[model samples]
Target: MSANPSPGSPRVALVTGTSSGIGAAVVKTLCDLGHQVLAVDFNPAGETVAEASGAAFFQADLTDAEACRAAVGDAVKRFGHVDILVNNAGIQHVESIESFPEAKWRQIIDLMLTAPFLLTQAAWPYMREGQWGRIINIASVHAQVASPGKAAYISAKHGLIGLTKTAALEGGEHGITANALCPAYVRTPLVDNQIADQARMHGMGEQEVIEKVMLKNAAVKRLIDPSEVASLVAYLASDQAGAVTGSSWNIDLGWTAQ
Candidate 1:
């Protein structure tokens, strides 16, 4: 065990989007390291995943600010303090700028970008109180690079990296660290849910979307596993990474190397 686990004890991690995929993997990763996790997601299925991971689950629609606040409150109530926050809640909408639905764009912005802000705003006090905190945002390669027909997604992800940098600056003096994980196409339900949509938009088969559309830019052509990302999260949330903050760590198969 490290010299100090979290805030004051075994770390308590609050991970959103825990219903499946990377979120579930993160919950397991943190738990295996002896941290208590509060898993939050609007999906009812999240409760099952939470149970399996031995985590406390909060079913919440994070698009609502109050719901964002309440989820953090529930985490504190369950574990007494929040030591780490993994802002992993998000949804994907694929469409060109000219035809994308306004409501869908707003929802994606609210859920993906706005929710992290509110959750961090709410969790900051607990972290500051303990003089220790970790904020990990699950951004995408879209945060730095872009593709056609994904105006909202690319925009939101780009903005998330900006937020990550700003938060890192503000949290530095308080023993709080904020960082973003920018991964290429990871084999998560989030990516699976988009295959049919990408196929329709690109006029290609689902497999083609995975190969050409998804992996085309990467030097290493493979879908990143959720466990691979989880391992990084575990390290960032650990005491050894205390000096690392305000950075966007890319696990993108050398996609951005060019």
Candidate 2:
């Protein structure tokens, strides 16, 4: 707790992509930490997570700039201000560069990279006024390394890291911190879908896909839990983390270490 009463008070956080997995876990974790949360996602499951956690819910397509702006404005309107923002809304398309559809590449980049920029820009005034803010981007190990296929996802994630760094620099002077979490493979709905798609692509079983594809590069032999990543998000949003900004913290279990 800080000398400023509002600094230690229960703050408002807006977490995008709360339909399931990492997003849902982050919403629950922030709520457990006593923050009023606005959980946003295009998926209907976001409503369920919000209800369970006592957080408000909003459905918005992040690829739409108007929708993204409205989501941030609505969070501010409902909560008086947004103290933190978790930019976790993302989608993956596994395809080689030669085979990847141009439209799909643009869509992935728009959601993962462009949307974070818009949300952060929209939220800057409120954060600057309060002299306190946290922005966490959920990037992936692909941001650091590459694998077969997944050209669009990797490119978008790499761009996200750049956005995270630039925003961190600009926000540092305003008591605002921005960072990215690059986790290898988390046991999320996103990974589950990847398992199925990889199985089909590699002619392997789903179990084989997990062992051979997802965990093959990690020193830790298990998929990282969504809750584990959520815990890190909460820590970064805490007052104690004021000094941590403009860094990509890897939760990749040594995937990038090798």
TM-scores for every candidate against the unseen true structure = 0.96, 0.96
lDDT computed for candidate 2: 0.90
Candidate 1 C-alpha lDDT tens digits along 1-258: 122243434698999999888999999999888899999999998899998988989999999999999999998887787889999988898888999999999999999999999999999888888788899999999999989888888888899998889989999988899999999989988899899999999899999998888988899989999999999999999888999999899999999999
Poorest stretch of ten by lDDT in candidate 1: 1-10
Clashes of each: 0, 0
Candidate 1 stretches greater than 4 Å from native:
1-9
RMSD to native, candidate 2: 2.3
Q: How accurate locally, in lDDT, is each candidate? A: 0.91, 0.90
lDDT of 2 by residue, 73-144 (tens): 999878788889999998887766788899998899899989999999998888888889999999999999
TM-score, structure 1 vs. true: 0.96
